[model samples]
Each structure stands twice: as structure tokens, then as C-alpha cells.
Target: MAKEKSVYVCSNCGQESPKWIGKCPGCGEWNTYVEEIIRKESGPKKVSTGMESVKTRPITLNEIEAADEPRIDMYDEELNRVLGGGLVQGSLVLIGGEPGIGKSTLVLQTVLRIPEKRILYVSGEESARQLKLRADRLGSASGECLIVCETSLEQIYVHIKNTRPDLVIIDSIQTISTEILESSPGSVAQVRECSASILRFAKESHTPVILIGHINKEGSIAGPKVLEHIVDAVLQFEGDQHYMYRILRSIKNRFGSTAELGIYEMRQDGLRQVNNPSELLLSQDHEGMSGVAIASAIEALGLF
Candidate 1:
């Protein structure tokens, strides 16, 4: 038997309350508290009699072996730099952007170009044919990449276990729903639970998971605040949809530098990596422009 449990949680700040309130006391947000269902302990409790097992081990830090592990170099230098020289193993990255901002295109291009690893791209928003058409236009579909059109998390997990891909990309996390949550898909509760399950799977399997998420009208991730904290990195893709330029900015990174940014130019064929970003940034023939000076920063990779 399970006991009935009820609580109120703020949608904006993720604050919890024992009783319903019109305004959140912690964040001072109005009309953000929503009643949530939580399972309470109902079974009989048993007290531990004594310690059944004990083990003591001491190890010195100097005795541990250390080695410099190499990272997989990607075709795009800017992305590689933003990911701290490369994508680390067992990392979970969240990419959020507005609709039609080329988030899907960027991941698809990466999967096609990464020849060394086997990638599994699971699409919940788009069908296989639709992805194929886009892949054809971008010239990104390769033999190493596998595409699956599924929305259920259970089916996705099954495919992941059988294929054992080197990398996994989930197109838009809002569409994914778990069975444990009674709320509908895309709800605050559903999104949080689904993301947690994915995070656990990624860490336990030592596989990198790339999650695509949609942003609200306020330019933030659509789900609750906990979604951002569960992942290892949060990358915000920002740029005008009409413009050819796209910027991949890192908001949070556990294995890499957060200050790094990647810039790319969208094209009909595919995304072109911009080597010298300043060239595109500055207007042509601005040699004698007023209040403008050409500043140079010497990058360690090379002079830019």
C-alpha cells in the first residue's frame, strides 16, 4: 500500500511548499505554485539490528595511475573548442533554441561528419522521411549514422541497448515522456522525470547523450529549472532565423570552458565552419570607419 502525498512546487524557481499558496514565498513569484503528487512510504519499517558487513581500505593519491587520454577530433574546429577540445565520454549536453533555428541541422551535420564514431539519432518530432530529406539536402546521411523515429522512451532505451551506439542524440526533449509520471507529456513533472532517466542512463553506460530542447517565448528552456541542473552542459543556440549565421554558446559546462563560443554559417548544402569569425563580423571595406578599430586577439591554435 502507498500513502497519499501532496505538495506544491513552483514552476519558475522549483521551490517546494507544503500547502497551496497564491505566491511563492521563496522566489516571490505569483501564481507559480502547482500541486504535485508524491508517493509516501506506507510499508512497515524495520530497524537494523547491527552492522552486518564492514570493510576498511586506505589508498594514497600518489599510488593511483594517471595518463593523458586523447580526445576524438571533430571536423569542425569551433565546436571542438567549445566542447573543451572534444566531447568527453559519459557527458550529457543539452542544446536549446527556438524553432527553425537550425538546432537539428547542426546535430545532423555533426553526425554525418564524425566518421570515427557510430551515432544513433532518435527523432521524436520528425519522421524518418523528413529527416532523410533534410539529410539529403545537407549531404549528411552516412553509413555510420542510424536514424530511428520513435517517441516512447522505453522503445528508445531498447534500441540503445541493442545497438550500443557510440553517441546518442535526442531531438527535442519535451516530446519525450516517461511512464512513471501521471501528468501529460511536456508537463513539468514529465519532462523532469524523463531527463533524469536519460541522465542516469548516460552516466551508468558511460555514453555521451546530446539532448535538443525547445525554448519558451522568454528565450529559456521550456521545461522546469531542474532540467538544466541535471545535465552536464547547457548550450544555447542563438541567432536570427533569417540570418545565415548561427551561434552555439555554452551556458554551463562541467568538462570544458564555459566562455567558448562556436559560430557557423548556414548554407543550402550544409553548415560551413567559419575559420575567421571577424571577417564575417566586420563589414567589408571598413578601413577608415569612424569609432572603429581592428583589434586582434592571438589564439593559441593560430593567428586569427
Candidate 2:
């Protein structure tokens, strides 16, 4: 049997050290070191026999075929416009917002609107009954949507493999933990590992994933910097809790433009998409109002 190896790793920069240090030399962060156990293996792990592996062939640039892939159509036109048309397969999206900013409500509404696709919504914070109550209140009773209340990444993967859903939504990434790491949930290590695993699954299965993440007191995603880099897109839901209007902004997009924005209005039923945004911004009630001017803004994809 091989002895287990242990090392202290900096939580900020992932630098390994023989012993705990008060300050991380790599990132210059103080008191960010944490000890982790490293298991020793005798040989390389065996590959699974379920899937057959194929070799790749190198081809010339001219021989490669290029075509514009169509995006998935959604019932919400405003959301489709903001996503640069619609959602793309095998894309990983990260959505973050403040508490009670209507992040969950926005995603739940989207899921309800898309009835053609099979969606798997995994909640780590809420129970199935709680989600059903919210869905009922929002009038979102869909037969195609599956709800699973789980916090373990391993169990989540198992459900994904069995269900084979077209879309997957993680309510909040901070609450999910992985078995590979010994740290608790919401830790830097656990967050990175869990997100990477989900990203891999989405890519390999050619399924789109929407990950809802919690922001820290600093209003940033509560994870390492690499978590943002691993995903294909990052969206932020911003608005005051007291305000009736909410904004969904794309910060990073690999398949589309990031300048697009989606606006929604909070109501007793649910989030209502603002189709004619200009009308809402400039109304007849605001006529003759000083210092207010109406300007025409053109969108790239002819949405406006």
C-alpha cells in the first residue's frame, strides 16, 4: 500500500507548499493556505470500456468545412435576443446575482417557457415541494421539466446520465460539493472541481448547462478565477430588490456577442419580458419632459 501524501495549498493561487504559510508567495494573499490530503496510486487508472475511443486525423485548413450552426429557439423572444439568438448546445453558462434579485425566478421562468426541451433542474438549497410551490405560483407547471433536490456532484452526474436531459440548471453552484475534495461545500477547491466536472459532462454529452451561482459580499462569484474561465459564458443579474425592473447582462460569451442585455419586469405572476423596451423607456407620459430625448439604437442582429 502507498502512503498518503499531504500538502498545503494556497486558496487564492493554488500554489503548493511543504508547510502552512502565513502569506502566499505566489498571490501575496495572507492566511489563505489550507491543508489537503493527496492519495497515492500504484498505476494509471483503467479507462472505461463502455465508450469506444477513436483516433483523430490531422487535416488541412482548406479541407475543414465551416457553417453557421442554428441556435435553439425559445418561447421568450427577449431572452432569445439577449442570448445572441438562443442557447447553443454544449455551452456552459454561469448566472450570478445578489440575494433576492430574482435570479432563480428568471431561470425558472425560462425553463417554463421552453417546453420543447427536456430540462433537469437540480436544486441544492430548495426542496422539490418548495420549488413546486414557486412554480405553481408562477403558473409554470410543465410536464417536460424534472426537478431533483441534491447537493452532491456525484449524485447529480448519475441523474444526468440516466435522464439525458437537453438542458441542465444548477440552482446555486456554491451549495454543490464534490467527493474528490475533502473541503466543505462553497470552498475554493470544491467549487472549482464541481464546476469542472459539470462542464466536462455538458461538453461530452452535447447538452447546454445553466449554472446559478451565488456572489460574495464583494459581489463576485464565490469561487476561484478559473471557474469563470472554464465556462463558455457568464451572465450577471443586477437590480435593486426594491425596484420592479431587473437587468440580465452577459459578461462573457464564447459563441455570441456580450454587449446584449435582457430586461424583465417583476410581477405577482412572474417575470414578464419587456418586448418593446424603447416604449417602456420613453412613454407618452414622459412627453414634454425636459432633458429627455429619444434616440434610435440599432442592434446587430436586426432585433430592434
Candidate 3:
């Protein structure tokens, strides 16, 4: 067994310190340091030794196949458009947003929409009953979708192996923890490890994964900066809590372009995809207004 020591870590930048400090030297955030236990395992650690020798083959560019990657459509045109037609297989996607901004609802609705695929919906933040209630409210109950309220990373992987789901949905990455790490859930180390594990699973199994994550006070995903690099996609759920409108934008995408955007309207049933958001702005009442000059533009988006 190896000895463990306590170290202060900055929650913002994931910087380590020997002792607690008022501000983080890496990020300059005040009172962001928290003590975390780090263990030094008694084993020869692997470093960048040297590249292993292996048989390799080189193919010309003309010999490479040229075809579109497979995609799983969410059935919602707005969401599908934003995702560059649909979700790519073997991709790890991260969704982040502010609290009470309908991130969970959007994901749940999307999962429900795609009943053709078997998805394992893992939640650490909500009970099974609560999720069922939300699903009921959204009018989306799929026999193919399995819901599990779990927080252990290892257990989740075990379940994934047993179920062999076509897609996996993690409610929030910050709430899950691994057994090997002594640090608490949502810690910098735990978040980083869990995400890497999931990413590995996604790639190995050729299964797509969607991870819901909490945004920090800076409006970025809460975790190490490397977490974003590990995933195949990073999407943001942007919306004002006071309004019913929501926007989904891709910050990064490995399979598609990031210029697309998705718009949704929050209703009692669920999130309704707004295929043409400009239609809502045109009204009979607006036609008679003096200041309203109906300038012709493509798709009515020139109103800005």
C-alpha cells in the first residue's frame, strides 16, 4: 500500500498546492483551494519511454474510403441540424449549461425522441422516481431506454458492459466518482479520471456517449481543461431561465461543422424543436406597426 498526502487543489484551474492559499496561482480565483488526498501508489509508473515497434502499412490517399460517417438521428430536426445531421457513433459528447436552464430536460427529450436506439441513462443527481416523473411530464417513455440512478464509475461501466447499450447518457459528469480515487466526487481528479474512462469505453465499444456537465461560475464546463480535449464534441445549452426559448450550440465537434445552431421552445409537454424560429417573429399585428419595415431577407433572419 502507498501512503496518501493531503494537497490543496484549485477548483477552477486544477492546480495543486502544498498548502491552502487565499487565491489560486494558476487561475487567480480567491478562496478556490480545497484540500484533496492524493495517493502515491507503490508501482513503476509508465512514462513516455519509447515508441513500440509494430508492423505498419501505408495506403495512398486514393485508396482511402470516402463516405459519410454513420449517425443516429434524434428525430428532432433542430437538434439534428445542430449536431450536423445526427449524433456520430463512437463519439463522446459533453453538454454544459447553467442550473435550471433545462439541460437535463433537453437531453431527456432527445433520448426519448430516439427510441430506435437503446440508451443507458445514468443519473447521479436525481432519483429514479424523479426522472420518471420528469419523463412522464415530457410525455416520453421508451422501452428501449433504461434509466439507472448510480454514482459509481465502476458500477456504471459494469452495467454498460452487461447491457451493451447503443448509446450512453450520463446525467452529469461531476456527480460520478471512481473507486480508485480517494477524493470525493466532483473533485478535479475524479472528474478527469471518470471522463477519460468513459471516453475510452465509447471508443472501444463503438458506442456514442452524451455526458451532461455543470458549468462553472465562468460559464465553462467544471473540470480540468483537458476534459474538453478528451471528448469528441462540446455543446452548450444556452437559455434564459426567465424565457421559454433555448439554444443549443456546438463549441467543438470532431464529426461535423460547428457553425450550426439549434433552437427550442420550452412547453408543458417538452422541448419543442423550432425548425424556423423566424416564423415566430412575423405576426399580423407587426405588419401594421409604423416602425416595422418588412425588409425582405432570406428566411426572415434579416430582422436583426
Candidate 4:
């Protein structure tokens, strides 16, 4: 048997309340609560997160082994630099940006260039034909990518098991839903649960997963605050639609430094990595201008 109940959840901090409140007691945010239905099963819950369960034990610091984290070369210099060399294995990365900011284009072109590794791209926002059209327009060399349009979390896992891809990418986390939750997709609960499940899968399978997410009107990722804390890295794609230049900034990274950034130029074919940003930033036309000035800056990678 199953029992259902309604509760108010804070969208900003994921605070729960039995009734609506003017302010969230958790994060002190005003009017951030939304009603959600929770379906509770009347039985002992089982842990099926794909991670192996080991007996609880403690080890001394001297007994623990330390090793370097393994990474996969993305082949894009700017991206590689921002990620502190390359994409780390078994890492769950979240890339958030405004609409039409080239988040999907960036991920698509990256995977298309990696032909040696099997990639699984699951998109819930765009259809297969639409993705294919975008891929063709990008004009990058094809790779071993398996595209599937799925929204159900259970079905996605089934595909993951059958395909066994080296890398997995979710086009947008807001659109995915699980059957256990009665709430609609994109709700705070759904995003938190889905991302947590993906994190477990990544750690257990040693496969990297990249999740694309939407931003709220407040210019933050459109989900509970806990969503950002669950992932290993959070990359922000920033640029004005009116400008040709885009910057990939690292907000949080457990495997590397967060001070690094990647620069790119959106072109007709695809995003062209700006290896030497100073070259484009200092132009011949601007040199003659009296008001224009040039200054050297330092990034985590090197001087620019």
C-alpha cells in the first residue's frame, strides 16, 4: 500500500513545512515555498543505488592510499584549461546558463570530437531530429554517440545498462522525472533526487556525467540549493547574446581549482576555442583609438 501527503518545500533551500509560511525558516527566503505531493510506500525501503555496500570500518590516515585523479582529455584547449587539465572520471558535472547561451552546442561538439570513447547523450528538452539538425550545423566530425530522447529516470537507467557508455550527458536536469514522485518534473524534489541518483551512478560505474541546467530569473541554477552541492563540479557558461565571445567559468570543483576560465568565439561552424585571448582582445583597429587601452591579466592557466 502507498500513502500520499502534501508538503510545502522551499525552492531555494529545500526546507520542508507542513503548511505554507511567509518566510522559509531554513534559508530565510520569502515566499519560496511550493506544494508537492510525496508518495510513501508502506514497507522497508531498499537501497538500490548501484553502489556496493561495505561494512562500516575506520582506517588510520597512514593506512589510506592517495593517488591522482584520472581525467579524460576533452581536446579543446580552452575547456581543458578551465577544467584544470581535463574532465575527471566518475565526476558529475553541471553546466548552467541562460537560454540560447550555447550550452548544448558546446557539449555536442565536444562529444562529437571524441570518437574513441562511446558516448550516450540523453535529451529531454529537444527531439532527436532537432538534435541531429543542430549536430549537422555544428559540422564537427562524427563520433560514437548514441542519442536517445527519454524523460523517465527508470527508462534512462535501462538504456544506460544496455548501452554501457563511457560517458553520459543529460541535456537538462529539470525535465527528467521519477515515477516515485507524484510532483511534476523540475520541482525541487525531482531535481534533487534525479541528480543524486546520477551522482551515485557515476561513482559506481566510473563513468562521467554532464548535466545541462536552466537558470532562474535570479540568475542562478533553477533548482534547490542542494543540487549544486551534490555535483563534483559546476561550470557557468556566460556571454551576452549580442556578443560573439563566451566564457566558461568554473564555479565549484572538488577535483580542481575554481579560479580557471575558458574563452570561446561562437562561429557559424561551431565554438572556436580562443587559445590566445590576448590576440583577439587586442585588435589592430582598437590600437589606433585614443581611448582604448591594453592591460595584461593573469589567469590560473597562464598570463594573458
What are the root-mean-square deviations of the candidates from the true structure over C-alphas?
Answer: 6.5, 6.7, 5.1, 5.8
lDDT of 1: 0.84
Best to worst by lDDT, what's the order?
Answer: 4, 3, 1, 2
Model 3, 205-229: lDDT tens digits are 8999999998988899997776888
Q: Which candidate is the best by TM-score?
A: 4
Error of 1 at 92 (Å): 0.3
| TM-score, structure 1 vs. true | 0.83
> Per-residue error at 277 for model 4, in Å?
1.3
Candidate 1 residue lDDT tens string, 1-304: 7666777777776787899899877778798777777765677889787666645556899987885434566677988888888877888899999999989998898878898688899998999999999999997657989999887888999999889999999997988877655556777777788899999998888889999999988888987888899898899988887689988899998878899999999899978888888778565686656986666563445567
lDDT of 3 at 38: 82
| Residue clash pairs of candidate 2 | none
TM-score of each: 0.83, 0.83, 0.85, 0.90
Candidate 4 CA-lDDT value? 0.92
Worst-scoring 10-residue span by lDDT in model 2: 295-304
For model 2, the superposed segments whose C-alpha errors exceed 4 Å read 1-37, 41-54, 283-304
Instruction: State residue 73's C-alpha deviation in candidate 3, in Å.
Output: 0.8
Q: Which residues of candidate 3, in runs, are more than 4 Å off?
A: 15-33, 43-66, 285-291, 294-304
Which 10-residue window in model 3 sums to the lowest lDDT? Answer: 295-304
lDDT of each: 0.84, 0.84, 0.88, 0.92
Best by lDDT: 4
lDDT, residue 62, candidate 3: 100
Distance from true location, Cα of 69 in model 3, Å: 1.5
